[model samples]
Target: MALSEIPMGQIRTYGQIGKAISCQSAQAVGTAVSKNPWLILIPCHRVLPSSGHLGNYAVGEDVKCFLLRLEGLRFDNP
Candidate 1:
């Protein structure tokens, strides 16, 4: 699956995943990610804002940052 393709310690943007899934809008991808019912299985936490802002996660931006940081992925800003 597309989510599984994301490397363990890397980050990806919603727009990138959208393109992979043949969708044109990153917002659409974000919507799909927000609705991902699989939670940890889908690894939706790896998806971020195209501007590298981290955006609003389904849970919260803090949780998203924590998970990414736990994976050793660094971000300049949320």
Candidate 2:
């Protein structure tokens, strides 16, 4: 999965993942990501919206923010 391909400390937008898999809908990608059962194993926390906002996760947004921050990613607007 493209989610697995996202390097640690890096992030990808939903549209980017969709494009990587040849899917045109970012919402579809978001849906697929939300359904990920592997959680951190797949690094779904690394996926965000095109607006650079932290989108929904199977886990809470706080946990997602925590994971991303732990990975050395900082957010000016977070």
Candidate 3:
């Protein structure tokens, strides 16, 4: 899937992923991401909402933040 192609330290919005896979529905992409069982292997953490904020994750938003930070992605004050 497109999620696997997303490099570490970089992120893609649900819409971006959808477009990559020829899907027009961001919500559908979000649903698929939410159901991903191979989180680490697939790097599902790299997917974010289009709002430029950290969105829902399988484990939790904190874990997602930690993962992203480990990959060199820094977040500004919200």
Which candidate number would show the highest TM-score if scored against the true structure?
3
| C-alpha lDDT (0 to 100) for residue 40 of candidate 3 | 98
> Candidate 1 on 43-75: residue-level lDDT in tens?
888888888687877787788788888889876
TM-score of 3: 0.94
Report the lDDT of model 3 for residue 22: 96
Minimum summed lDDT over a 10-residue window in model 2 is located at 69-78
Q: What local distance difference test score does each model get?
A: 0.82, 0.88, 0.91
The reply for model 2, stretches above 4 Å from the true place, is 76-78
**What C-alpha root-mean-square deviation, in Å, does candidate 3 show against the real structure?**
1.2
Clashing pairs in 1: 53-78
| Candidate 1, superposed: residue stretches over 4 Å from native | 76-78
Which model, 2 or 3, shows the larger TM-score? 3
Q: How accurate locally is residue 55 in candidate 2, as Cα lDDT from 0 to 100?
A: 76
**Which is the winner by lDDT between candidate 2 and candidate 3?**
3
Best by lDDT: 3
